[model samples]
Target chain A: MSQLLRQHIEKITPLTDSEFTYILSHFTPKKYKKHQFLVQEDAPVPNDFFVTKGLLKASYTNLNDGKEHILQFAWEDWWITDYQAYFNETASSLTIDCIEDVEVLCLSLHNREKICAELHKIEHFFRRKSNAGYVALQRRILSLLNSSAEERYHQLLVTYPQLFQRVPKTLIAAYLGVSRETLSRFSK
Target chain B: MSQLLRQHIEKITPLTDSEFTYILSHFTPKKYKKHQFLVQEDAPVPNDFFVTKGLLKASYTNLNDGKEHILQFAWEDWWITDYQAYFNETASSLTIDCIEDVEVLCLSLHNREKICAELHKIEHFFRRKSNAGYVALQRRILSLLNSSAEERYHQLLVTYPQLFQRVPKTLIAAYLGVSRETLSRFSK
Candidate 1:
């Protein structure tokens, strides 16, 4: 499990064995069954979960309609959090739920800051990862603004074919902000 | 000009005078008139620009309709870049242009990495800023998914009233992913 995290960080910066071990000490491991909730709306969000195995989704449900909008999906080696709540130490504005049986190493904001402040390379690792995440979110915003349902479906398939294989089509529709009927038309 | 950059970094990590001076040395200052392009599609993206004065927009033009989709707007003290192209060292997929007469300090990818590697505090500063940007984008994605154009318009107004005053309504409509007619109805 820790190997997954070490590999993830090493992609951005090399870590000596002792450094890696020290870094691992900041995280606590936990498991969740498929459909378990890691975060729920209006509840305090305490940790950012790094998925060591399985899949999960973070979503917002519209208050009036109770319609779920999938904000993001995370599979193995990815991180998921209600970031605004986590950083602000406030109640969650979104919920995160497991899509498959999952194992994650959870890090609180305090531990994350402690690690970054303590290890220069660890700080560098996080900065690089955050930049990459920013670029990806920009691409998603562009797609949401410019792409048709068919174009979005094709783009999603090309970008994350694994997601298409693993996730239900209805959820993909939610992520793309398209109706179920429209999703069927494009996927067909 | 350097003061703005110094203050921006100091928000997250206080820098000694020499350190701020060293960091500022990596950046080059330039000015552009309203409507001038800083980054053009298919060209190399060599720098990330920090706005010292005026406003600029980064956008992708859909090939099928030649319609522009505003990815983001950068005002005084904000940063703008074709980040995917800048970080990956590839041709730009979007264009960044002045929305108002603009002055910016440009930092190459090499310089940014160099500064971050040389200064752990600088790396921490950037990581914090990037995390905040990630959270903002997530909020935008939620708004795009769940809100009506009027709701988005009101949200934008409440969040950034300065944008409503500075940007043209057409561009605001483009950013909202709503028809001009729809935007007119909401604004009127």
Candidate 2:
């Protein structure tokens, strides 16, 4: 557990055993089987999970047409949650479903508040992470506005090459705001 | 100046005069005339500006078609910057222009680093701000994927009604991934 957690933190900042333990104390470990739903739309989100292994996709379906859009994908070392619900304490508008059997380090809003109140440095670490997430989403919005379907597909390949293999092509196509047919043609 | 700075801090967390003064000391007052560029595409961005008066728009243009997309609009009490550039210390891909003659409080990377190092509470405040920003961007991306032109326009109005009056119709339409004509029709 420490090894997996350390690998994730090292991507952001180096942590000593004491620091890692301090952070680890706030999280609880859990495992889920493939096709498990971590969160469901319209339900309250109680916790945010950090992926230790396997894959998960956060998605939402349009009420009018019932078409689903993949909002995000998480592999090892990534965090997954219905962020809108997590932050605002509202009913979730998205669902997080496991694509592969998974292990996660889960932290609830209660634990998170305690950590922020007690360990301020950890708060700083999360702040930096959130800033990076914002930057990535901003870039995605810009790409949607300016890039062609082909360009976005190429970008996904460049940015998250691992995602192509880990996620189904149909989900990847949805993520790129294109049809699977378009993605198939682009891949060729 | 203190009142404005205090208001900014209180938006996230309450701070005493000494704490507010300590934070304010790190910000440098800046002025830009109408149409002045605060940041340009492919240029280094070193600071985030807090608007004290007037307004600004952060935007990018497509090289192929010369079409522009407005990423965000900043009014008094709001923060603006090429966040991708500021946080990453990379050349900016977006440019920020003074949409109206403006006065701003600028915080450089150096000062921000010092604040994070010396004032732990400031770091927590920043973390909360970043979290909120990340949530907003995530919602925006989801809207782009699932919402229609009119739905998006309506959502935008519900989210940022002040922006409707302050920004041009074309810029707002572009941000919503629509045309000015379509936005006009939707608004009616």
Q: What is the lDDT of residue B28 in candidate 1?
A: 99
TM-score of each: 0.98, 0.96
| TM-score of the first chain in candidate 1 relative to the native first chain | 0.98
Candidate fnat values, all: 0.85, 0.84
**lDDT tens digits by residue: candidate 2, A1-188:** 65887776677667778878888888989999999999998999999999988999999988888888999999888899998899889999998998899999999988887777676667767888888899999999999888998999999999899898888899998888788999999999
Candidate 2 residue pairs in clash (backbone atoms < 3 Å): none
> Candidate 1's residue-wise lDDT over B68-181, tens digit each?
898899999999999999989999999999989999999999999999899889889889999999999988888888998799999999999999889999999889988889
**Cα lDDT tens digits for candidate 2, B115-176:** 97688778878888888888988888888888888998898899889888887787888777
Report clash pairs, candidate 1.
Answer: none
Poorest stretch of ten by lDDT in candidate 1 chain B: B140-149
TM-score of chain A of each: 0.98, 0.94
Per-residue error for A26 in candidate 1, Å, reads: 0.6
User: Candidates' DockQ values?
Assistant: 0.87, 0.84
